[model samples]
Target chain A: MSPSDFLIIPFDDWVNFLVRDWLVPNFRPIFRAMQVPISMVLKGLDDFFAFVPMVVTTLVFALLAFKYAGRGMVIFTILGFAFIDMIGLWPETMTTLSMILTSVLFCTIIGVPVGILAARSDLTWKIARPVLDIMQTIPSFVYLVPIVMLFGVGMAPGIIATIIFALSPIIRLTNLGIRNVRTDLIEASTAFGSTPMQMLFELQLPLAMRTILAGLNQTLMLALSMVVITALIGAGGLGLTVNTGLGRLDVGGATAGGVGIIILAIVLDRITQGLGEQKKVETTSLRQTLISLFKPGAPAPAHAGKAA
Target chain B: MTSKISVKNVFKIFGDKPGHALDMLKSGQSKNDIFEATGQTIGVQNAAFDVKEGQIFVVMGLSGSGKSTLVRMLNGLIRPTSGEILIDGDDIASCSPAKLREIRRQKIAMVFQHFALFPHRTIAENAAYGLKVKGVSSDERRERALLALEQVGLSSWADSLPADLSGGMQQRVGLARALATDPHVLLMDEPFGALDPLIRKEMQEELLVLQRTLKKTIVFITHDLNEALMLGDRIAIMKDGEIVQVGSAQDIVSQPANDYVAAFVADIDRGRVFTAATVAIEPSTLQLADDTAGDAVRTMEEENRSAVYVLDGEDIAGVVTYQQAAAADRDSGTSDVPIADVLITDFPTADRDTQLADLYAPASSGLPIAMTDADNRLIGVIEPEAVFAQLSADPATPDTEPQVEADQRELAPTA
Candidate 1:
């Protein structure tokens, strides 16, 4: 074959070459550097004092429930949050909480709109689907390399990697939510003389909210799990303590952090999934359920034949 | 009523290769060929219709029949492929986006089948959404929303979010939202199509009541024929992206234009449409002529008379029409009942829109209903002779008719 006719490498092949040659060799040093900034962001939160105030937390959580679930949900959330605290691990848990929350917030800010765009356009879905695939499928260790390159170690790098890995579900769910919004409902909003903005805010977004919440729920859980892996990049939280303890053969400290992660995961996941499922059950049309609910036999209204 | 909506030849062909699809179809390519070649689907086709002002216009068909697509075209939800949709004489197709927005906000509102309640907002907020979207102040939105909820009997549920409400309650909130907008026209695409049968009926009646009070011009879409008959002032039956027939339920049922139209009528239980308003009533017999038989004979055989309603001056008299009894071509065996002895449902008639269940008698076949003025003076008779002629064509061997004819045959004609 002529030299001009030769193909050197595909992107995937090139990617593998880079990971094997440059990425693995340089990754450890970058993770060592991420330790500083991640620690600073987390220092104030210490898990216990780090709490964003129970009242504020309660109110925010309550508002979320009122919107997506129902009123009684707020009470359960408050109790759950308090119980997790009463069990101690306050400062350690708070540090982990801060990491999870911040990671999720940034993820949402990026993920939701991408999902919405995906839902809106076929091209968007096609484009976004692959990016998500890469983000999700790439090894968790592989994520540390990019984080290390940008932040050069510490909590920041860990946060970045955590964000990359855990955020896929958020984007996926958001897209699912928007796409799942019933076309009939959207048309209904438009026919009602709703402006584009109104239709978005009133119908499309609201109906899709359940799916979006599910995405959020999944993302939060993913982020929580990844934060520990991010500890390898010096993003200190419960993960740091766990990793360090594991390194030193101190099973007690590492186990505590692991337990804390599980608690936070449970608390967050339950609340979110509950809200999404609740919204699903609740939003079905009223007139239909009532007549169907009461009895097998009901008066067939003559006017039903005439619903003009 | 003026025609509020006018659609002139609308088509919506969906595909990457509409031209090729249309060409191949014309060139004897089947649907599979069109699909394989272009990945195209026809959404709606050459749909032309109008809705009169203050009239309840219903579009009905089964799923994928393009009925929903036609409704979407009304308010520009989906622009037609090639056509002009005029609302109040203004063609919406060429209108500016700003104007379309204005028309939607000020002129049209839709009630959805799913209710589409906002889980984030309370009933009042969902109800007030259209107004809020229209830039109405908070106070007015809330006030109107509350009032709308009250109209739907959901005033107490106003503070509740959709999640707290039942499906039917949420639907009430949906209605409240549409009402809050106060648009000149309300478009409902299967608004109650999702409800259970009983609740669907209740909602239907509720809509009728609301329309009676509000008098908003309504354009409703549904698949159920009975719903169209009960709710529509006029119904437009859609099939294969075209309106097979458009008329009152009685008109469509009694006078179907084709097989497709006949199919719709056949599926519906005719007990409701066959009302006293439909059967012709008696006319006055004020002539003081002494010869009763001679007079009856002369009146029966009058030249301009297709059918005469026998009546005693605003009071009903016996109806005795001659349809097949005096046809140019009649079956020899059935003609034995002389024209005079032939009893017809058209002779002892009521109005043309009478309820079948109302006139429950031992026998009401071949009985003609008389049409009379308010003073009880007979004017005309609605003879069932036409109905009889239709059925009596082959009485010796009554072929399989639908359940409706079997049910209706139970009410025998009585003198």
Candidate 2:
């Protein structure tokens, strides 16, 4: 027939047989067990976001934005949440928020330690580099079927796929940040007799914090972008709304969902980016911020006043 | 003084398999040869020296000369590939990591060239870092950190962040961090190499002033020869990972070990490097009890000198010039006038250890500056001629005959 016909090896069939006959049957239980933690956390966050009154949630988020991102962010956050509420997408938005939060939480829990390990050992980095490359570069939909076969189609599995997609940046950046600490600073710490743990916590971690926060912001953005894709696997959120609207070819509904996602993304991005850029010395603890918020004559937070 | 830190035949070869490089090196191959053959860079080679207690032992070299690498080994920051590095007789090279860390925490501290104060940390926090590593209580560490900051004249900046301070002040924080531990020895690796010249000079003076009281056994690394001569009680000149010579400022200036060392010392200001003790000639004297103005005049004439010193027992009464002695001899109308009566007691004097540069004013009187001991006894005399001779001597000239003749003339004045 053709030259190409002679070279065909049915690699797709091999992968299919490997997943269906070997991996799914033997490792399904382990995969299910892995989903349990994600399910619990996702359920808890989803319930909390849903149960909280819209006004109170809005106020709390706005206060946080004000404290970290300044008054401009505060105004945007309040108006953005109000607009989402006006569109009757509050519940869906809550579910999406929970999904993004759960994914980020899990990615940080797994990614940061792996990143630290990679930074410490050349062998670990060599092994991780290629795996992270595959996780990041492969089309997000390619692994959807495997994730579905392993963990089944649901919110937790959708979030799991999202985690796989979003985990690379945090790990890569964390490794880079820790490795890039000034050698003289490292030497100074060592010369002062800092033990390995002390050096990590006192010198390395504190110094690498800004870089790590930037990584976190990147991870958050990736997680947000994955929402619509994850919705294909039965994830309920603004992503679901958009998917349903598109199915019926309702342009207005899809645009509303798109607007809501953009609003949420911008608020979250600005807050986290501001957090990354905030001067470490000038930043007050949350407890202090709360105290200052309620204290008389302390109308604005210390950082806000300084910024103005 | 007892040796506080002793480094003996230590070598540090950087590569995956240093043993091969070591074997090659032991076979008498040069560092360049070993590197070319095996791809291993020799950081320090066969380095051996003792840093006596309270002495500033400066290891001076140009960049890539391994002076930094050698200083790092003293604090166990870089372990030697072979041989022993002993701090108070304990072999740090062979010690366990835990023991090495313990020794570093209690016995030694280091100041970096870049003033490696943590950017996120406050001045106090950076200063307290050493004590924090040692598990000191928070309040106590803060108190001690403040005290150390006070030593560096940065007590008021304790609460300020490191970025808020100037470069010199940041280095002071680095010094304060080192001093907070109050360790027995301080290792400074080109600590002022990054500062501006004016700030470097100020920091050097401040460190010397601090060393006077702290008396911490210091091993200072610098590429600047003037810095080495100004601050070092003894200097070790390193070249290509090996110490070319180790001696006091006077010794290294007057007698460089090899051509490389001579070239290195050639550009140094010899007027400041050579002290009065180094250039001083033995004094020509007339005894206060037995010798008279006529004896002074006869001695000056016989020696072809401008002046003679009058000694009352062991201590100098003053100097008697040729004109003064002859004038006294003529005015008295007799040869028995006491030498003290003609002695110019108001003549300028200097300590034997005073630098030749500092002896200029005393030498300007056109009389030999009487070099005295601690107890005011006349140990020697610094003639203007000898000062100029030593200052102007070309270090590149292989012929040392003029120096030898000058050395002989110093002895001949007293003979």
Question: Considering every candidate listed, which one attains the maximal lDDT?
Answer: 2
- Residue B161, model 2: lDDT of 78
DockQ of 2: 0.49
Model 1 alpha-carbon miss at residue A199, Å: 3.7
User: What's each prediction's TM-score?
Assistant: 0.68, 0.92
Give lDDT tens digits, candidate 2, residues A1-308.
89787797888999999999999999999999999999999999999998999999999989889877999999999999999999999999999999999999999999999988999999999999999999999999899999999999989999999999999989998999999999999999998888988999998788888888889999999999997789999999999999999999999999999999999999999988887888554766778779787897764555322110
Structure candidate 2, residue pairs in collision: none
Instruction: Go through the candidates in order and give each one's C-alpha lDDT.
Output: 0.69, 0.88
- DockQ of every predicted complex: 0.26, 0.49
> lDDT tens string, model 1, A1-308?
77658765477778767876677677756656545554565554444445567667656766676655566766766675666566555556667778887787778888988877887789989988898999999999976765665467766667778888987998888878777777766766666566666677667787787788888888888899898988897777788878987999998778777776776676677667886788645344446557757867765322222111
lDDT tens digits by residue: candidate 1, B1-415: 5789888877666766677666665576555566777898767766676777888989988898888888877888877667799999877777887788789888888877778766667778888878877889999889888898889998877766676666676777887888898888888888887778988898889889988889988999999989999999888887766676676766667666566667567756665765554444343332322223334445657643444443333344344444643551144443233333432434343443446544444125544445444665554554445333332232122223322222122223321
lDDT of candidate 2 over B185-233, digit per residue (tens): 9999999999999999999999999999999999999999999999998
Which docking band does candidate 1 fall into?
acceptable
